[model samples]
Target chain A: MAYYGTNGYGDDAMDTESSGPKVTVREVESGRCDFVLQNCPLALANSLRRVMLAEIPTIAIDLVEVESNSSVLPDEFLAHRLGLIPLNSMNVASGLQYTRECGNCDDHCEQCSVTLRLHVKCSSPENLLVFAKDLIMVDGRTDDIGKPVIRDSAGNGPLLAKLRNGQELKLSCIAKKGIAKEHAKWAPSAAIGFEYDPNNKLRHVDYWYEVDAKDEWPVNQKNAEWESEETAADFTFNPDAQPSAFFFDLEATGVLEPDEIVHQGVDVLQKKLAEIINGLTRSDEGMNGGMSPDGYEPAPAEDDYAYGRGGTTPYGATAYGQNGYGGY
Target chain B: MSNSAERDTEMANGEAEEDSADEQELLLGGLEKLVILPGQTSHAASFQIEQEDHTLGNSLRYFINKNPDVEFCGYTIPHPSETKMHIRIQTWEDTPTTAFDALRKGLEDMIEACDVVTEKFTDARDGFEASKQ
Candidate 1:
């Protein structure tokens, strides 16, 4: 009867948001309903489940990124392709393209550039190669398309991406399924990034130089010091030439902390549960009692009218028998 | 017998006769058959009485509408050719027993109101007939 859709990307910076690529879909009907979600974070999916269970009839969910950066395969199709796994699996750390370079500015030149690093540590040698190969392939594709690439001079490889010890591959694809047809379809409709300044101070400058001196230097001293001015001059001061404390202020905007984001998702789910319970309770109350008119008194209970031997008659028993129950 | 005694006796007899007439009129005008059909449930209830009146339809509607919980799904009124009045009520699945009971009470009230109207109309008609005579 009612339909609702929330686009997670309404916030302009989708790329930088803690939760990436999210979509929600809800459908309701007279007797039953279905929900399809996709590309949403796990915490979000769980929260949506609670909201839906309150009133929806049937729900089917597909969590795409349970193993982060994994391919976005349709759940039904995947289930048929691969047998169901009873045990939970950990996310595999994959390579992310950090930088790339080529000589021609076009991707064809060997002299142009070479570098590739991964964000995650490979579990094994084979995994390292596999991850490296994947990153190279991705870089090649991006270079061919003329996209800007981050180049790593340290790693002489043609393509450079990073892989932290626990950093896993975060693939760009649908992370969930269920009511996700519009936004979390087979692919993400768009990619967005978020950035902010936490301190709110406008000072982002790196260097400051100041020169101070007395208005009139001793006249004789000045002339004498002219030749030795370099050694005796108090006019100029260079505060340590070392670079100002290397500082970077990158604040989170629309970027939820991992835990906070998870909690937000769960809250949506809880509200849905309450709605379902309330709907059921209301239906039961209307069935039994007929409408009672305003100011009407309830009739006496049947038990109250019953006398000693049997239930009270319309008139006295003696009068009823003698007159054969004549008219009132 | 003394005059006052005689007068009292006469008044008592007259009162008895008037009571009998009123009873006869009420019996003739009362509901002939009442049927209440609840929504979705297959079974319908039927009550037999002595006469038919338009009050049955109005009362049924009033009863269902009065209850906040009773969500009327639909209703059907019999064709003019049908002899007895039939009323159908459909209530929301969530309605409580108290609300349903209230609806039943509303129906009874409607019926009583109808009886009073019918009795007044009958009385006026009788007066006109007597005057013509």
Candidate 2:
């Protein structure tokens, strides 16, 4: 949750010595974010990406009830399409749980789910483009409830299905919170990845000024130099830069904001790690005399007096090793 | 065994054992080999695994890609419909053992998280059912 200064590189920059993560948001809008992570390892960055992409839960159409369908697409095919449509998942942070996980006994309840009904009967001779806007949220929310869930970045209502004259489709879809591990529809982000950050520094301003307008610079000729001294020289090819830092870019599926996705990703990762630690700790404790339910149990050692060759001699006799089968 | 540990943890976490769940045999078998990659300061490994689908492959890639020591990590399914997944991992600035340790740790963490979710839901369900009485 901490924000680092915009200075990407400096001798006395944010303390890399400290374990605290240095997060600098380069750009953040509704569903897109570019951020720089200093003092973060590749693993942590990758974990954040993984969590944001798949682990972070989002609402999606899980179940569809079709009342009627006479379109070219079968009822199952139409339901499948509806299920793939992403829904706004910001409600997850607002104390909403998955329908199955919720306290509600009803399969379809408002507290854990949202319902969208689509009924399109094309009467015109021309083909009708049934946009996402056509699927009205029937749970008493505004008409625009499903509008933000569209995968199109432009927020335009995506065409759900095409209907010919006299063709109709009637269905109710239930949106529930689930992870992308279960299905791609629940993935919060369309893409999440990071690259190593090269911490570059400008050593000599004069060197850059001399190289300006000359094709000597390694980078693109157009981006070689600033027009004036006031403008900063391009450090596109700095050989010296910190290798540990990473630049991360995440594009959301409009289910959650990009910054929120990162926060949620980190939160979910921490909880997951904590759970693992707890399980390991419990297992370690169970090693001490705890009855392992359905686990391995060593067989008790057999007494030798009853079955050994020494039994033929005497109860207290020690068997000699003279015979091949004899033993102590 | 790790399987015993997983089962115990799942039971403690109130995970309902679904009879039809896909076996993690492919992942476990691949991990058992611990194939070491050549020409890396830190131990690196590349291996292929055949499973029923790409779910485990994608999950493993996502899990392993998060290690700081993992210099390069990528996976290819080879074909769109093929179940065989090839994963290549290169690690530097840390021991190859660290990468393996992280993989084991990541899988355990995922299992544990599922347990927690199952427990939470079970508790909520029990309370709801009790209230109905």
Candidate 3:
């Protein structure tokens, strides 16, 4: 069977039947992780990176209303700030549809959007800080909407504004599901990138030869300690130890885990490839069915055979027969 | 098209007839959401995007880094796991909106290129089948 490349797995680490592509976590935290991916092309790695950055869906504040604002910020400015607040999206993956596509409402409804209200009035003389904690889900709708109310997991909501004494502010906001491709708020990964991993290189020199300087090769020079034979160094640089392997750094937004971002990216990539394959297959089936270029109907089978054999004239000359007495 | 026009009219009329109802306990806001705010060379826009952590903030920063006109671009999530993403952008000689326009354009170009690739693949497959027949 033909493979995608001549050296199907590039430059060193050969793949056995059991070892195709290996992914081992190098480091992981609540928001970020790094992993080593072996035996995969750089192209696939980059595609996954792009998919993680642009394709994942998350919920965000889509609309806002400022009923009254005596604060220093303008209404639009305050609304703009309110819209930038991050909401927990644990429920997004469970089939929460985009508000535009929701069938139940014209613009938005409880099923498509969750409303948040922020109302604050400063009575003291000192400036007051308005934080995310102050914003509450309206109408006890969090339960009614079936979407969890976005909470300030950090306990203290991050500060939004500072209001002087006697300044009052009131606003209402709505959150909805969306992807980062439409807006940056929904991007799943905080940071994602990859670099090629150096592979081991083996060298067979005269038994007494000393290994070259560290600057000469990019791989770690510590592997030179493995030279066993005294006369012939038989040094192995370990440059090809992990061929076609890459070190990937991935950081997830609070909405998803780092591993889930990678998994979802691969899932999206597979789905896209499947769609292309399906489309190509459909085109092939249509053509094989003898569909005309502009239509789906197949060419008449008998007519095709008769035309190929020259058994019928192009304009029906056989109807006139040998004599010229045929009716017009 | 007609449906869109009707919706537009309804939206316009809805905005015209509205004043915030005080007794409703701050629950009455319209459907029109704030997407991007206008500015001179530097602009700040907030979207209702739930960027739980640095994912979107970093991705957008990466994207902004690719634009020559962008002077600086950054995002902050004021509340964790809350649905708000604030993006601030500064551009070199161009309006802040241009930076966002470029980002949108880049996305559109990628989509168009992908569509073209799919179309070409379909055409090639059909041609191969037709020749075999």
Winning candidate number (TM-score): 2
TM-score rank, highest first? 2, 3, 1
**RMSD in Å for model 3:** 24.5
Q: Indicate whether candidate 1 or candidate 3 has the larger lDDT.
A: 3
Instruction: Supply candidate 2's per-residue lDDT for A28.
Output: 57
- Over the stretch A1-328, how does candidate 2's per-residue lDDT look in tens digits? 3222123343222235453345555555567876656554344556556667777777788778899898999887887788777676774744455443332433447766778888889999999878776777877743233333665565546577899999998888877666775567778899865654221223322334464533443432111121112222343533333344556678887878776676677667655444324323433355311122322221121212121122221222221111111000
Q: What lDDT is reached at residue A198 by model 1?
A: 13
Best by lDDT: 2
Per-residue lDDT, model 1, residue A113, is: 20
RMSD of each: 37.6, 18.3, 24.5
Q: Model 3 off-target regions past 4 Å?
A: A1-18, A139-154, A198-243, A281-328, B1-133
Candidates, ranked, DockQ: 2, 3, 1
- Candidate 1 lDDT over residue span A12-65, tens digit each: 221233533322212222222222222222222322332222211111112222
In model 1, how large is the Cα lDDT of residue A57? 14
As for candidate 3, its interface RMSD to one decimal place is 26.8
| Per-residue lDDT of candidate 3, residues B94-117 (tens digit) | 454554454443234333323433
lDDT of each: 0.26, 0.51, 0.48
Candidate 2, lDDT over the whole model: 0.51
